[model samples]
Target: MSRHEALNPDDHRDLRIQERRDAALGDARMVCIVVPAEFRALQAEYPILFRLNETRDRFSALAMFGFENGENLYLADGRWDARYRPLAIDIQPFLIGGRPDEDGPKQIHVDVDSPRIATGDEGVRVFDKHGRPTPYLERVIEQIGELDHGFRESGDFFAALQRHELLEPFTLEVTLEDRSDNRLVGYHIIDEARLNSLSGTALAELQAAGHLEPIYMAMASLSQFSALIARRNRRAARG
Candidate 1:
């Protein structure tokens, strides 16, 4: 139930997008799609995980927002608490659309139904009076491009992981402050043990091929779950 349309600067010049976080503004996502380019930044703030998309037939990188579905711990009081907000969330209602013309450049489409978009001036401006994309919109366009490249690279990265037999199933078992167990399953994480067991030549090749750093980043991100658990405990205490 999304109303998406190819953004026309002329017609949508007056459109606005709120800068703050709000579940009602379509930011209530438990997981946000991330490209390999964001792994370093997001790893510091979130536990990066790989998710399979059956329809796309591709493995995608995701930033874990909360331990449970439909829960975004980063979103509290209409503000994003994380210092590093993933570009996937920043892109908002704007998504990549097919080419505007047969051989012309691709178009950025916006969802009119998204609560982020409005007629009144409140947050980020989509266009200026001259009918040109505003600076904020321009940055969003750039991020969309970054995401596109990241997706392509991620496919190859995942393939490398598969080839090395490094993708392993992970089940996170956490005992909250209430002594209730929260078991998160059905996701994959880098197998640090297996990765460390690789031969020197293989390790060299993987590093030269630009896969080693991200692997370690993923391994390091697991510790962030402590922060996630703390947030969950706080939420429970509130209730």
Candidate 2:
């Protein structure tokens, strides 16, 4: 298939999901997926989604395939890069199902990679400890974005897999790979959401199956329900 054809339009996203899962399971390559808050409501209605996550409050969500490739993929804003690898994964729960604290707006914090020092505010070439613009490092920097105190960003891996927390189970890893004499650093966060939604017997089935911990349960459902109304307009225009 042509590269563009390889990607599924938003409407056929489910088909692409199955294809990726099948490929990962068949190849035994370690794969991770994240979902966004926009789709969390779908999981609530269909409890089946929780089967994919690797931990609680974090949504790695695809352990069954057991595909052991270390490379990470990122998808967001309708773009996908199948080759970016994250060096670190961080998680912040939205504080759902708990007493409210007057700290700030409820949200989750997902951070990937370590902070990098920039030459100046404009941000120039990424330099090595020896002051060299490493090509691979540049690509990594561009793909992952420059890291700094003000730029708290998580790669799209967590965002894409946010929806999948309802369907898969998996784990997070912090890894460093050595290419030549330098080190490439990265990490991930993962889990399934069912552990948080089940109650009494229905909940026991998942727990007995070694699936417990609901990442979604910790975070309140999206309060701005009207945003979905905006999505309807886009869908209508497409139609």
Candidate 3:
């Protein structure tokens, strides 16, 4: 359970955050929501794809880290062994809060019940005795702000992908380390055939909209599935 509230210096003067990377820190996820801005960075580590958010009735781009729910192959020895951690994973126990004033800047809020919150002098302080945000908290503010802004722009990017008719449903069948048969469906990715079939003018429009690079990045990232399979095999062997 997460008890989230807008962080203010008034009541949260003693709020501190424990910087931990253990599995309990909640990084163990099969899919991390991502924006196009992080696509280039995410592709190097995880296979990027899109999945339907049934509740929201929208398509969200995601970096697939595992085949099963709550299964993250990048986790080991209480650490995440990946060169690039998606922004979605990095920003935990925090979310962009809506504002009463429509024109106001995004506000940052913390989940008080989150395991990451601590006040035993073992982690980063949210505010000092003088009630000023610490440098670490300042960085968090900046990162969360970036995520908030990027998420809005990402919505338009998804719409553009739809406009160009580039996304397609994909299914994968693979044998895991436990010798169990797995079939992953209900995901979407760039249709290479349709993408290649686009006219030059259409490609130019996509490029002009700043979505062309990320599309290629997502296509290239499918190869990382091989890396993920190897990781599963290694983890299974050790067990």
Candidate 4:
């Protein structure tokens, strides 16, 4: 369970957050939700895919980290082995609260129950002795704000993809060096063929909506699959 509280200088003046990546800190995952705004950076390192929600009424973008559930290939030696991690992964223990479209200001909420919440004097302090925000806290606030904006803008991107029939089901089959087989299903990818065949007007519409670049970025990210497979093989060899 999570205990979330709106962050305030008074209540959390001495709170410190552990800045480390490990499975025990909830970094163990095959995939993490991503937004189109992050596609440029994420595409360079991870395979971008899409999955339907449980209700099947909405599609969410994903940055795949491994082939199996609870496996994060990037995580090793208590570190995330990547130059860039998705904003969703970076903003841990803190989240944006309240409606973005509302007139009221958005709030930053912290998960007090997270393991990243330091119990001793071993982590980065969120605030200074004068009750002012620390540099680390400022960075976290910026990250959370960007993530919130990206998440709100993602709905339009998904809607455009749906309207244009650009999403196609994808299944990946992997055979490791040891001859073990792995299969991944229930994911979607950009229909490159359909994208190529789109009418000029359709392309114009997508471009006008600012969704074209990310669409191509997502398609380009598929190449990362080979690197991911290599990582899996390396892990097996080490084992």
Compared with the true structure, what per-residue lDDT tens digits does model 3 show for residues 107-134? 7888889888875777788889999999
**Top candidate when judged by lDDT against the true structure:** 4
lDDT of 1 at 172: 87
Error of 3 at 121 (Å): 1.9
Of 2 and 3, the candidate ahead on TM-score is 3
Sequence-dependent TM-score of model 3: 0.93
Indicate the worst ten consecutive residues by lDDT in candidate 1.
Answer: 98-107
lDDT by residue (33-87, candidate 1, tens digit) is 7877687888889999887667966567788988777889888888999988988
Ranking of models by TM-score = 4, 3, 1, 2
Model 2 Cα lDDT, one tens digit per residue, 1-239: 11112111232222211112112222223332323321233233221122323354543322111212542222223332222222212111001111222233222111111122122333223334454544533343333222221122222334434433433422322221221121211332233345345458855654453333333421322222123223323434555
- Name the candidate that leads on TM-score: 4
lDDT of 4 by residue, 122-228 (tens): 88999999999999989989998888888789889999999999999999999999789999999999999999999999999999999999999999999999999
Residue 7 of model 2, lDDT score:
17
Q: Rate the local accuracy (lDDT) of all candidates.
A: 0.83, 0.28, 0.84, 0.92
- Tell me how many clashing residue pairs each candidate has: 0, 43, 0, 0
TM-scores for all candidates: the values are: 0.92, 0.21, 0.93, 0.96
RMSD of each: 2.6, 19.6, 2.0, 1.4
RMSD of 3: 2.0
Q: Model 4: clashing residue pairs?
A: none
How many pairs in model 2 have backbone atoms within 3 A of each other, for residues 3 or more apart or on separate chains, i.e. clashes? 43
Global fold similarity of model 4 (TM-score): 0.96
